[model samples]
Target: MPTAAPLAPAATAAARAYLPALTGIRAVAAYMVCLHHFNPFAEGPGLGGFLHNLLLEFHVGVPVFFVLSGFLICLRYYGTEQWTGRWWGRYLRNRVARIYPMFLLLTTLTFAPAWLAHAPDTTRLWLLNVTFLRGFFDAHKYSGIPQGWTLTVEECFYLWAPVAFGLLRRRPRLLWLQPLGLLALGCALVLGLGPLAYEGLFGSFRFMLLYTFFGRAVEFYAGMQLALWYRRGLLRAPRGPRGLYTAAGLGLLLAAVLALVAVRGQYPYGQEAPAGIALNNVALPAGIVLLFAGLLTEATWLRALLASAPLQLLGRSSYVFYLIHFGTIKGWLRDYVTASPAGQFVLLNVLAIGLYYLVEQPLNRLLRAPSAAEPAN
Candidate 1:
């Protein structure tokens, strides 16, 4: 028989890399976020009461994504001059290109049902959602797609990133300082410092500029720190007892997820029900950031699993799925599936994947176009 055609060197080289594994991590995060949105298999509304807390406990995945984004931004930008440049216009342009189209699309999608039913607050909600001010005011807190709250946080970070990088420019090593300082200030406010100062400051619209924005900054900075560590070779690539690391990281994640679900059910909407525990806001995000860092750093089979192909696809498209799957993906599912938790999840995930391939991948091509200026430095 004729010898098989020799494998292309480039193809072989591509096969040996680890980026796909990182993509798989992205997939896991996206799935967790989807499950959280489904609100499924828990003890409350929507898809709750099916599984025994598996889905309910995994809501920490979003904060994990926040951390990952922070880390990846540092990885992509730390050495690049554009990120550390004089004007923020270019950075703003890139950020807008990445998020605005999908945001505008989702805002419009939220309006369709309202228009159909002539919902009274529809127009105002649309305006708030599109303008990135949805979470700043109490009136619009639960309006539009409920998931848009994270987008509001993301918008602030995008605006603040330049100021952040600028402040840390001279020291260079102190780059992590700015976001970390912001994070600590936020934690203090959430722990009631703001209330002590202004009597209702922490929970007010003005306070979002203080508390919510800073609280999530921790996740981002946690990621940035990891990126710095990895670059400095303080974080070696995984090559040890991968199985044990994977198992522990996953088990911790599961426990955190379950506890949050249990707490939510017992308390309903009152996050402070435990009185002194500070369960909802404090523990959950903290646990998520810790677990994610553990997973990203530790040597484990879990990391390898995260490096897989299918997971990577989900991970890369996470932003797209996040933006579209809420109303559009699930909204399309009404005709085909039973109105049960599992059915809704299956429908949403499938639609999310399709949207990723159809929309997200194509749009991300913009990030790859060569810049006219010298590549960031």
Candidate 2:
């Protein structure tokens, strides 16, 4: 009935800045994962089980985050190539400043006391987590923050993204080659190291397909392609209706998730199976790219809601919340404050905000001070 709001400058500007609605989407993704882990819905064979299983598939949040990372990284740094030592230093410094400091602090805090008391075993696990090598081993991936496994996938992408962009610059049609090669490498690892059966090294096909960056690189590539089109000003909105793309994106995402729920037969979730893997690793990311493109170009109510001040703050602090949602901090919350799911969600968000301002922000600033605290790229 009324006119839609204008899009944010970050959405369409040539200058690279963070999009507010996308930041809000970060909040949604982190919270979806938290809910997936701490779901309170009743589990039964009928409608109740269906509802619970639907929530379980909220693991799709990880894909949303992956796609966002790819989009933002490419959007911000795609063509800003210097390729010199100083530029590489600055770029890596920025990425490290953004992620590593808080992750290191929290990860150490997670394992320190246990390491002190139980030096040998805990020390090795602590080393694995701190180095992020734990993510490569299925037996150890859940040792520390649990969700920290995603960081491994992220770091791999970070190291490889520039190379990918450079290759795409030369061989545009071979864009899919990067992810395909990664998939082949993963299969090799499974066939080679999997035979060893040594501590779940290289892991099962399910682990390789579902968890590793090699298999999940398609999601990032999807985001990268979206960024390329968007930066070229090709991601135009329709003349009248504002939310059609948003609605379609939501429909596609829901259809994928519901399909995953439907096919969970004989496995914990549908993604453990071959068909489920294709849907999650590919189809789900397609929905996310559409959703993000809509958010970037249109001024729908969804965009306005995501751009609101509170959601912005929540989105800013969402990384902290994602890290703390299920592990040690949640335990403390359950022990000290409230045992209820809803209550803990609220309390955890409050704490995450506090940590963002008090801890992550300060460390990020200090680390990036040598180079102005911006992205190295």
lDDT (Cα atoms) of all candidates against the true structure: 0.58, 0.85
Q: What TM-score, over all chains together, does every model reach?
A: 0.72, 0.93
Cα lDDT for residue 115, candidate 2: 73
Query: 299-323 in candidate 2: lDDT tens per residue?
Result: 8899999999999999999999999
